[model samples]
Target: MSDEEWERFLRETVKDTTGAPVEPSARAREVARRLREHPRQAEGWRTYSPARPRRRKVWYVTGLVALVALLVALFPQQIVGWFGGDDGGQDGAPLAAESEAPREAPDAEPDLRPTLAEPFRGSPAARWADGAAGITVPPAKATGWMNAAQVERALKQSRDFLVAAGLDSDVLRGERPTKAIALLNPHQKDVQDYLRTALSSKKPDPDTDPLLLFSRFRPEQTRLVGDVVKTRGRLTYREGKRGAVEVTADVTFVYPVTPAADSGRDAEVIRTIVRRKVVMSWDDPAKVITEPGTMSLVSYALDMTNGGCSGPTGYFVPPFGTADEQSTDDDRLIDPYDRSKPVDANDGTTSADDDCATATRS
Candidate 1:
């Protein structure tokens, strides 16, 4: 056959889809050359281009290493954490708000020691209202025979007398309680004559002493620590079976005193706790011919804590800081600040019972 006829026959017999010249691999040529080698193997043309030379694996390894380096540069902290290095923080480890040293817990106990400036600091009286404001009177209602207005007037008069007798600065400074005395009925000559003798007398009896009627401190000796006085109590009133209105006041007074106001702050200040319960009687004007708006003193109960046992009845001398703190040998534990206890009448009031006892607190 001619060369052109042979090429046309090859093209027609074995088609080349790429439109390029057809070629054979060495394996295919060898297979065709050696018919006896293997007759069962399959054969087919895969591509039209010539095979490329293989590249080394070193380039692939280098590319992978570069990718890892780029990631570490961008996220340094995350990279360090993966490697478990530098505690996963900048410079060193992470810091807390207070990283210097562990601090100790603070003390829980309160400082109770009294000072001239803070006399009521540790005592229960610290929370009490100051002066006359502390004396709280209940709402005046019509009690039995007395009208509401009369009841209110009687309550006010009772509170005024209490303020004069116990809370008045002048009375506390060894001055007579004229305001308190004027509130009492002049018909109470026994109570009046007794008060007159008690105030002037040098060695008065404890039960009927001037101190029983009022509170007084020697101006020559100790002085008040601060301008304010702490007080707390309640006033109550009721009409009795005899048709007379009875008004009573129960109050607690806290007086902080030092040798003098000029004394140093560190100097020990003494606290005098006095609880007084005074009874005032109002006779009905229609039934009895008595003074108008005047109430007579029926009876009273006074209790003082921390006063000197042997001191004279009229003046108060509180135990000194330099002396033994546990001066009272009596085991009778009494909380002077506790107003819940019943009012003590004749114990500390009578001359024979001039004794001291252990106090639970200042």
Candidate 2:
């Protein structure tokens, strides 16, 4: 209520970083007077330091907001509320924190950076649906070899594989792709075995890199920002060369991840985009002894953006700030987000080890 109380409060509450008691200075007295004289002037408390670095400013604003809340709670009687008069809000709603708001200073830009709460804010994936919903199937039509219903079944099965391979939480966290492989016809043991070895190997070679078929992250190194994995792409079907209906899935999956749970609140969010072109055949029962409801693998291709090249070759390693994609004299940088055209399949290179391209964004 009086100068004596204010001084006593400062002596008890305030401290320097070194833990030394901080006696309120003349500037603190002036700032206190201004806060008391004009309550709305409390809005000016946001303007902490004009020349501080952007991140420091964020921390400063956050500190100021927390301090205000503490003061309001601890000294509701003594501290004339800077937000309102001696009487608080009618409903007694607690004060809101403008914690991370940029101070009102020159070059004080708002933190438009992506965060765990809004991982895909500035990305095209923001508009995409989460997981398999984005892989839209075309209206089923009778292919030359199969009926409309068979074609639709093939498309749905193809989508299931996509979901398991890329969107499954267990698969993404570097687990086995059992669900994805189950969709395959058991007769195609060679293909299934190839996939198994691709994952079973601790370190894969160029042709057997499991990332080409599955989206996986090293759990010890990084973790998903949230449970959401935004996806967008299409599914189509046509007559296959082997007298079967071939369903093709062309889809892009975007994942936002951070260094690990221990990484602080402001940890950088790395966006890794994986695009796959998977073809599955609805085999002709008359010609082949196929399972009643199974799709056989025809062929597939993979393209990725922002997955670093130098990490363990088995899984996709999304780097902290920028992509660590390796470039060779024969390889070129490509836009991972640009799905305007199909990947140049004729290049004959099989893996990132053979034809790694640096990404523009990560």
Candidate 3:
């Protein structure tokens, strides 16, 4: 085709691709027309035009080729990935495998030892409700005065005693009337330390009163089954010339697990501090029974003979002041895993000495 025709064709094609007409300068168009008009002159066109150096063209071509090569090199894996290849292993699953096999939920921490519970003292409802608030007096251990049938009769008669004494009807309605000892604030360390100290010794002081054992709700072990937890406990009381004394206030505490705080540590803090206050209260000499014989009896009741140490296991006990008895939700509640070995409570498996004593001795 003629150079002018070729130029017009180029213009139309450019317009089609770029949507704009290609325009050659007037001088360039005239030159292209003259060259095309003379075949001989067109043949000598390269000589007159003085072609660019071969090295420059080579460099330009090399630069374009290198650019294309670089693009391919940079995304070789991506190119292969478009066609589906192992090199790009379906969305970096290989990279994930190379990094670390998903950190397994860091080995779960070993659970803490489960605590035991105190026996239920009063009616089921009463034991669950006024657990640590009910009053207890020394029970006359006069077996000769009562049999099963007579005890049932006494319990029926006790309803009048309960009303006169301002006790709850639930406490008197049961076949057996139970006395409860509720401790305000008993020290945990003092109770544990006292038990360890007293139990280690065979001959306790006649003048020294027995240590009173009391139990309260531990938030860590407790669960919010419904609105309230059913707690059961036993308190060893003794009487003397002084007054009624709580020799041992060992009770099972049942309460809801207060939810965790926003920081996730509130539950832990509550469980640790709640029982501590109760333990410290029992340490106070002024509030505790001071009669020598009564104290001795309290101590003996908590002694190994009574099997008091082998009480409740894994009972839910939340500390007081954790929450109003009305609040319900597990949002901030503290829950603890039970590590207490399954026990045959029927076979007196509660004795910690029975379980761990051999381990310690060996």
Query: Tell me, what's the RMSD of every candidate?
Result: 21.6, 26.5, 27.2
lDDT of 2 by residue, 1-362 (tens): 89999999888775545686679999999999987898763336557645656898889999999998898798764455345332321122222221222233112112346677778755545545677777788888898677788777777878888998999999888999888878878888767676777878998877678887789988988899888887777887788866888887778888888887656877888788887887788888787667877878777787777677774478777767654747656556666666665854411127744557766553
User: What's the TM for model 1?
Assistant: 0.65
lDDT of 3 by residue, 218-313 (tens): 233333222322322223322332333223332223222333222232323222111100111112245453321111222212111111122223
Residue lDDT tens for model 1, 64-163: 8999999889877666745654331122222222212223411221446777657776565665677888887878988866888988888898889988
- lDDT at position 81, candidate 3: 41
At residue 339, give the lDDT of candidate 1.
Answer: 65
For each of the candidates, give the backbone clash count. 0, 0, 39
Q: Pick the winner on lDDT between candidates 2 and 3.
A: 2
**Sort by lDDT, top down from the best:** 2, 1, 3
The lDDT of model 3 is 0.29
